[model samples]
Target chain A: MVEKTPILDTLTYVFLVLGILIVGFPIIYALIAASLPIEDVSKVPMPLIPGDYLLANFTTAWTKGNLGTQLINSFIMASGITIGKISVSLIGAFSIVYFDYRLRKIAFISVFCTLMLPVEVRILPTYEMAANLLGPIQSLVNVMHLNWLIDWFANYDIDISLNLSLLDTYPGLILPLVASATCTFLFRQFFLTIPEELCEAAKMDGASAMTFFRKILLPLSKTNIAALVVIEFVYGWNQYLWPLLITTNPKMMTAVIGLQNIIPQADDLPFWNVAMAGSLIVMLPPVLVVLLMQRWFVKGLVDPEK
Target chain B: MIKRSIFSNPYLPYLLILPQILVTLTFFYWPAFDGLINSMLVSDPFGNYSRFVWFKNFIALFTDFLYLKSIGITLMFSLATAITSMSLGLLIATLANRALKGKAIIRTMLIWPYAVAPAISGILWLFLLHPSYGVVALAIKKFLGVDWNPVLHGGDAMVMVIMASAWKEISYNFVFFIAGMQAIPKSLIEAAAMDGASPFRRFWNITLPLLSPTLFFLMVMNIIYSFFETFGVIHTMTQGGPGGSTNILVYKVYQDGFIGLNLGSSSAQSVVLMSIIIVVTILQFKYVEKKVQYTG
Candidate 1:
């Protein structure tokens, strides 16, 4: 290995600083805008430092925006979707990878193909399907069904109706995201990396499919599960367009929606303090998750070759 | 692992994939069929739920000036974002691949935007360019003495949307490009350099051609993603404003179905969009797959 010249090293540092500033500018700007005082917010030359209105601004946003309720709604919605995506993905991945099947090629291709269609293209039909399923259950009396079999269908409607309304309701925020091809794809790729010999040995030992999956596959793929969990969690947490479409109840909004709704409608925008507070509140979880994923996300992104 | 009878075992895999199949069927295939049927019925996106009047939606879509404009805009947005972001991504990946001091820090910083939700990214940009008292707005007004208001103009808004989309996508491309670069053996580069190939010559001959497979994978994804996912940015930033100037096909699908309550037309749009994507993806696999070199 050859050592770099001092001039080349200095240039690297210079480029790094520029790169950091470019990436960090918006985030820093958001923080500043969220923390500045109301009066100073509209000044021609924006203030460069944190101002005094941080607490009051946050308090106003918290109370008027109903941020607490939204946070809980977001948490519940994200959790439901994450559980659905992960469980469904695991089942699908296990079947495709381990099972000796005739339809393997078709199944694998279909799952891979679905990756080309993102959320928007699929939203229309999914909306209609969701609408047809949830239209009746949205009614108050129908939501009260408590019988076991009926309850399962009832829960589906509850989930569907909540997502359809795009208003203040939990299901409305979560249902659309319950299934994700990306999650499935990631699991499939990871599952492919597991040695097939282990499964063959497990089969010779008479381990059932479920047991082998649980004992061998699940433990082996822990890192992928963790990666997918974090990715899905962040996705569900920061989800905006679908939630924006369905939820009408301001109080039922998720944290992201709450922050968006907090934009002041007055002739002048609100104090930077409140905007900053709202942004900070909505931004934290995803940032923390990204920090967690930095180690694994890179590796996963590159593993298609394997 | 269970090693049941082969015939019996095939069903197990099918059973495993059943949930996905059902969900995909319900959510994707059903709507696709519905859209195909609806596009032929001369109804609005949600209205005219009556008998079949086939090919009417496609006909109308072709004839309508607004629909035509949307097609043009969608192509422009997708193509521009794809080209610009791909090049920028390659450049950034190259820089990061130097693995010089603090390259890891650079990589982390590069990825910061990927963590910021697309919706939030749009909002942040909107705030920065709020035209009156925003940061970028003030900067332009002060430094250039010209007020740049994207809200009022279609052309300006379209350019802004593409730039914002590209900005967010650079991180995506960077991640994949770096990975692709990493997979290339350093020995190849060393061999090229020892043969008296210049740095630029080495990269063009050894680096880029070798990186093509990863580049190709990302290219297909970039096009597909621009078509479908950029709608979120359009929705949050422009809302297809200034008289439908920024309305891409996917956003139009949303508008026709959810906002305009025109399910039939929206379904038609969905069918058309999906068919195009499927065809394009198949072409990639058919033609480009042969060129991908998976060097470990």
Candidate 2:
């Protein structure tokens, strides 16, 4: 066994310290800036000491920036999206992994192809289609389609219109993103890792496919499900462009949009304290989710190795 | 084995894939297909496309100097960032791979910033490097004493963008590299050491060559990720600004499609971008893949 050199050990510490500082600086700086009083903020070479205005700053950001409503908007939008995406991905993944059909290869390839295509390119056409096709149908059915039989099953029908003014609306934000490629991919990969013997044994016991998946695979994939939850939550929280496109009303905006709005238009602007406060608020959920699921993230990363 | 009932099974594999199938058709493939169609026609007042104009947008794209320059700039940015990030990642991974104390703590801290979204990372750097009142700005002014502004300066902006992006990216790539390196059997390295090889010599001869397969995979993925996935940073930091010096093709696609209200042109640009990536990917698989051995 070879012992480490003193020089190497010192170098490692130095490298680690420097790397940690560089990485942690933003959040650290944000915390300090957000906690500082307005008077202290004016000091040149801004004071490094923690100030006592944290509550005041939080109150200001909440009311002045309307972050309360923004938080609600973001939660509703993200939750709707999460539910829709999970549902679609579960169904899609099950089909891709379990079903034996012709065009399965094409389905897989098309999904892979979607992974490479930037969402920006399709924004325009999607907007037009959502407005014309989905909007109209939804509205048309909402009135006449909501009937006595409908009272038994589900709540509403699709809206029918060519209008796209529903940008900030929940349906507007949620409808276009009902499916996710990454989730599907993850599910497929996880499903493939499960031995077929369990499925065969279940089949021999007279279990249906749906029953097998629900009772067997679902329970076995607790880790994957946890990983997917954290991943989906983080993604939904940090999403920027699509939400920005679909939502124009300030009341319906997310924390991300709130962060953007808080940025000042002038030089020597953005009022670092306020911006930092807002950024911290917006970043809190994702960071917390990651921290809680830190083990899951590590496992997710390593599982690919196996 | 061909069960006749399987063909008419109500819930077919294709049906399982139907939601995503519809999503892809309506969103990705259909729009791309529509773009190809629209490229041939002019947009009318009623939103109706006119008669065909074959190869017009593609030809126009070639003639446009700015578009061509953007394509070139994107390639440069992707290449520079990928190489810089991968090299830094390898170095960090190698360092982390040593029998070092607090390595787990170091790994956690090193990867913390990667949890920060790309948009936030750009903003953090922008604030830190702001010409006035920024921590780094004041230090540079007091020490170097030259007017150091990242905004209005092209070279500085590019360097800042690259540094910010590369710093963020290295952590991600390093995670993969570290994992890859850890997977390598320690006995191989010890066996090489028994042959009178110095640590440095062993690293060069044994460690690096063995890590090449993972490195190659990283190289391909990192390059592609940089090419398409860097729009968030560009959009937030420079918005391809300081006289369009930082506008990569993907950023240009965002600008053209959303900002400029020119869907046809944006689609044309995306098609070109797709072609470049596809070709590069194919070349990597066809040529470079044969040279490496993935033990896993």
Candidate 3:
């Protein structure tokens, strides 16, 4: 900005325009392709302008691609992960920042260690664990040769080997995705910034920890909660690998996964129009979230202070 | 990090933290520990029996040609994606910082790509580059006379996945770069300008060095992104296909474990990836600590 010459200003505009075009081209192209008729979609050099079959393509994508059910599933998954992560993180952060427990440091370290193990790295075991919620315990029992102990307890008709699987379920889709170290750290950082006087004043009133947390801390965390909700919702909605692996039933798939189903096989004639429409349908929610909640989204992303 | 005036009720704090601790222990620790154990165990064809062969799986991976090739492919992919995304991000951020008008509009237009899921971005690119009917593919064939078939060509497939991955990531890098640029002191630039320094000279001398911390942070983040987060792109776009040309390590782990049913090899791959991530993360944290010290 300092001593900006005319040529430099012109070059700056040129580069910015080029950047926008490169960034926006795919979405714009998808928008145009989604509006095309079925026949024109496969034509070489697909049309650049919008077409009249927009509603028809959307209808085909909706019914044939099964996007309606999938969108609902995505909504449930996204909202579930958002609310669950925020609640647990708030309480987790509160405990770490407000209490003097002996195991506080250990708990923090354990939670922080989760950052090193992404879902992709441990896919098989995670799938196994989700197949049986008590799998680790079962493995421990087996490894320790505790089968005889279970058998001895079976004399009273006790079923010690309980099977609880979370597969093909909402909790399975949502819960594994909810253990976020970043959100807990974010809340911890925010809690550290709250003045000591507030806690002291609340203590002078002889208020319980829960009362102080509920009455003051929760209200104070509105902005942070809003920002985190935007980030987590987008994260949840955009999830692919976990949801794709967890949900075997087509009826339970997320919208993003549903887009794959609608794409014709490599051997089959590609239906570019319907596929693009499906892509648009899949991307709509998170894109809208980013655009509408732009402020909170930017804050959650770029601002470490949040 | 605790408050001076703190809650002393021990039971309530435990109750409060129980959900997160339980989830982390069950989901993260259990799975990670299971992967470590599984890496050492080889099972029969049927799910009948297994025996421990410690370090054998890792040795096999090192000796296997396909696994070695995959490691090379992963490094290349991560490096290419990180460089392409970060350079473009820096360029755009610098330009945007200089522009005086419509800055908000330019930003909104650019950052929406951050919201586009990697799988969806892959699908969009697939539409543009499908060999038979893609508009851009056809245009390239016409203008450049190059036979562009990603389905059959390994090199083309790599280019496609890299572009798709980088396309989705540029916005993230751009956001960080913009923040980094904004954080630079204006007086420094103004003083350079008053000394009759060219904009290029000032940028190269002062701005770039000052932005090194942000650049380093983005480099680590982008490497991690290309490593782990591009799973969806590779899955939907190439499926590690055309004779496994586009197979990154994360995708290979899934394919080998879930599809090939090679549990030991896949778990070993997972362990390898975990180490990679840990190293990169530690590097980033070190840089962050240094940055904090410089600022604080």
Worst 10 residues of 2 chain A by lDDT: A157-166
Which prediction has more favorable lDDT, 1 or 3?
3
- For model 3 chain B, where is the 10-residue window of minimal lDDT? B287-296
**Pairs clashing within candidate 3:** none
RMSD of each: 6.2, 6.3, 2.0
Q: What fraction of the real A-B contacts shows up in model 2?
A: 0.32
How many clashes in each structure? 23, 14, 0
lDDT of 3 by residue, A1-306 (tens): 777499989989998999889888888888888888867888778878799888998999999988889999999999999999999999999999999999999998888877645687778888889999988788777777677676676654344474799889999999998876888988898999999999999999999999999999999998889888888888899898999889998878999888887776788767888898889888989888888888777777877631
Q: Write the per-residue lDDT of candidate 1 for residues B87-114, one digit (tens) a residue.
A: 8888777767764667677888888676
lDDT of all predictions: 0.71, 0.70, 0.88
Show model 3 residue runs off by greater than 4 Å: A150-160, B291-296
Worst 10 residues of 2 chain B by lDDT: B1-10
When candidate 1 is compared with the true two-chain complex, its DockQ is 0.43
lDDT of 1 by residue, A192-231 (tens): 6666678778878988888888898889877777766666
lDDT by residue for model 2 over B122-177, one digit each (tens)? 66666666666567667777898867777788766776677667766777787778
Best by TM-score: 3
* Candidate 3 residue lDDT tens string, B78-164: 999999999999999999999899988888998888888999999999988899878878878999998999999999999999999
Error of 2 at A132 (Å): 3.2
